[model samples]
Target: MDIRQLARGTVPWDRLERVATILARRYDRDAVRVEFLAADNWLSIPCIVDDEWFVKIVTKQHTRVHALLTAGRNAGALSSGSGGFFTRFETPLAMVEHEYEATQRMREIGCNAPEPIEAFEANGLGVLVLEYLPAFESVDDLDATRVRALAPELFATLATMHDNGLAHGDLRAENLLVADGDLYFIDATKVLPDRQAAARAYDLACALAILEPRVGVRSAVAAASEQYAAEDLLDARDFLDFVRLRPDHRFDSTRLRSELEKWAALSEG
Candidate 1:
């Protein structure tokens, strides 16, 4: 029961058909029963590839885009006035392969990252079959009370990732899905090791703002940050440039900084 299924021809049927063929040949299953669990630029098709699985298929067109993106990243890294930005470009297939490696390493580090069951190049696309999370809900639909309770755990998970030198560049409510009161992260295209302090701080600040919809902005940033610091993740003042990036809602950066200053002074006293 997928929204796109009802509205056929809405998404790229040609791409799905092509990927389905590849899956059928690879898994020795019927492509006719291929169903999408979820998708964005990449298609998450549900299939039985020796067992229950969600196959994430990335199209060749997207890989070409990744190549272009890699070029851009290299240029940006070279042109960056400071040593803050990194310049590593990966092709689409390489990207999926790298993600698989990162997942294994992160698991060893005790971080909650999804692992791929199978990863390879197929149908001119990067095919990554991964273990799907069962019975989970994004924080967006959760209430303020529930979010407040989970807030500390969320920061703790982030702290673990940072301690191991990884940065989940995108930390939003959607990317954080809770199952049984624990957190698991997804969409890790930007997750990398040896990340800068600024990048890690950005992840924390954005996470606080993401909780704003569930809790008020100031309250979310302050409360979560208190645990974020007390948990030895980071000092609140480190998020001096804390600002909500989503233009739909404006959370004042100046107010955030001033509030953090007071929170720190009070903590010291």
Candidate 2:
């Protein structure tokens, strides 16, 4: 089994059946087809219902993992000379509900995101339902040329979120999807309300880290410069080393930092 599968744990077959039954009843169907996805997710058991609705079954274990990850992220923030900005949910339902609301907020702010249907508890498990995108590719799955073309829009969307007082506490290539030629964000994590600046810088750092490996340091920094000011980019620099520590992000941090500093200097001149 994959490491993520082990970390995500497994829901009992009967539990999944109960969830399917509940979904069938909620959707007014006699029965529903559940196709579990082998997603590299550590927080939930993701599945598709009748190829129409995307569902995430969040268990107690998932909540525990989320809390632990949040705590680690908080520590990372502290290392960047900022207070902890990441927030943890005490229950599975809270996790799903926050993600549901965050997705809605992103859409309300004119950003592309899947339509959140609902979040509810089924037999003590947190269940979140959303519209399924039949066709999409994660940024990580895209070619370098496509990623290069999409880089500016990615930063633009991030800027829009920041300008609207919203921050995607979790920003990574896998969390960003391209569907029908548009970028869609998913799985936004919770952050402290009063620590938007820290969260924003972290998000910027993650974006740069994601793009640098795909498009090179110069292109990544250039794309980021279009949406973020020199000072914003510099602030993001503080979080580069922290972001690099994540296994999901692999990039030449030293080179990326040099490129960012060069760009900032040129902007200052």
Candidate 3:
């Protein structure tokens, strides 16, 4: 079946059947139903087969992004989280492809990230199918200890990626997804190339600064931060800045930024 031809405007039920049949023939798997899912940065169509797997046919732009991102390079910053369409940028395909690739690379390095199944594009639609995670709820549910636990793991993963020459420029809470009771970094459009030491330090510091306000020094957060710092993956100033930036439980960005600047001065001094 011509995936491209079948992927025209709105796929009618008959066409969907033909597409499923083609997929079964090509991938050697039986499919049950095809339904539309969320379209955050890329258009997503979830195809449910047997109990074992589901095929998410993403648009072509997203597919390209997954491929590029896995190579460890800067695609761009992603505005979306695990939810729905968040940001708009050119080269949707390239960004999505790189994002998927970066996440896969992170998992391979023993970092916490979603498991990628397959990514491809046919008929202007790019797609990536990944092992689904069930436990993660939302960013708001996380507390200080959780953040602390997550920070080190995340930093370690980022360090590994940097060692291999990959960078995720946009490091925020929303971009992280909890799956199977573990944290996994999801979006990768902002991944950079070459792993500049100073840049990594700056990025990590900024993230810490941002997280400081939210998680604070709850014993868990403090312990996690100390462990991560021991890796020499983060600079003292950055870590301090992170501590300073921890947000008030009320979720105030302005106040957080104000606090970050104060720490920034201390770091500069």
Candidate 4:
């Protein structure tokens, strides 16, 4: 069995049924159809209800995994010469509640995100519901040319988030989805309120890492420059090595650092 499967753990059939029944009662439906997603997610068991709501069922094990990941991320932040900015939740409900609030905040600040429905606990499990996107593709599924075209917009969105004091503590290709030719952000993690600046730089680094392999370091840096200053790009540079350490991201950090330095020099000249 895959390690991710073991880490994600499992939700017993009876408990899951109780969750579904609660959802049905809350939505005033006689019954609801639940489709479990085969997502490679470590923190939640995702599903669709009645093809209308996206649901995340969080277990105690999920909360424990999140705590571990938060610690690891904080350690990475420390390596970047900054104090840890990532926040950890003590319970399953807190995890979903944070995501729900984060998503709502993103949409409130003119960022594109799915409509958040509600977050609640049922049968000792945390359940978050949001409007489901029936037709969409993750950024990872797009071709290079398509990604190149969307690169600037991606940076622009990140800029909007940062300008409003928001940070997507986690940024990866899979967390970005494109529906109807519009970009949508999802699965934002919690960050400490006072450490947003560091989180911003980290977010920028992750974005650069995501685009580097598909669009090349130069193009990635170029696109980022459209929304971030040369200094900001350099600040993001500090987190490149840290971002590379994540299992989800793979890029030529040395080349990215070189390109960022070149871009800064050209901007100063």
State residue 16's C-alpha deviation in candidate 1, in Å: 3.5
Tens-place lDDT per residue, model 3, 1-269, is 55533433244466456656655666676654455444332234565554334455555444444444333222221111111112233443444465568678777777776677666544544455566664565454687667656666665566676676665655566667776667677655442333345445545544555455666623323433443443333242433333233342233334444444544454456
> Which candidate, 1 or 4, would have the higher lDDT against the true structure?
4
The local distance difference test score of each candidate is: 0.59, 0.94, 0.50, 0.94
Ranking by lDDT: 4, 2, 1, 3
| C-alpha root-mean-square deviation, each candidate | 5.7, 1.3, 8.7, 1.0
Q: Model 2, 142-253: lDDT tens per residue? A: 9999999999899999999999999998899899999999999999999999999989999999999999989999999999999999999999999999998998899999
Candidate 1 Cα errors over 4 Å, as ranges: 1-15, 24-32, 37-51, 63-89, 191-194, 217-219, 230-243, 247-254
Best candidate, TM-score: 4
* Superior by lDDT: candidate 2 or candidate 3: 2
- What TM-score against the true fold does each predicted structure earn? 0.72, 0.97, 0.58, 0.98
Q: How does candidate 3 score on lDDT?
A: 0.50
| Candidate 4 global Cα RMSD | 1.0
Q: Where in model 3 is the C-alpha error above 4 Å?
A: 1-22, 38-56, 60-96, 143-145, 190-206, 217-269
lDDT of 2 at 249: 92
Where is model 2 poorest over a 10-residue stretch in terms of lDDT? 1-10
Error of 3 at 195 (Å): 7.9
Clashes of each: 0, 0, 34, 0
Local error of candidate 2 at residue 5 (angstroms): 4.8
Q: Which stretches of candidate 2 lie over 4 Å from their true place?
A: 1-6
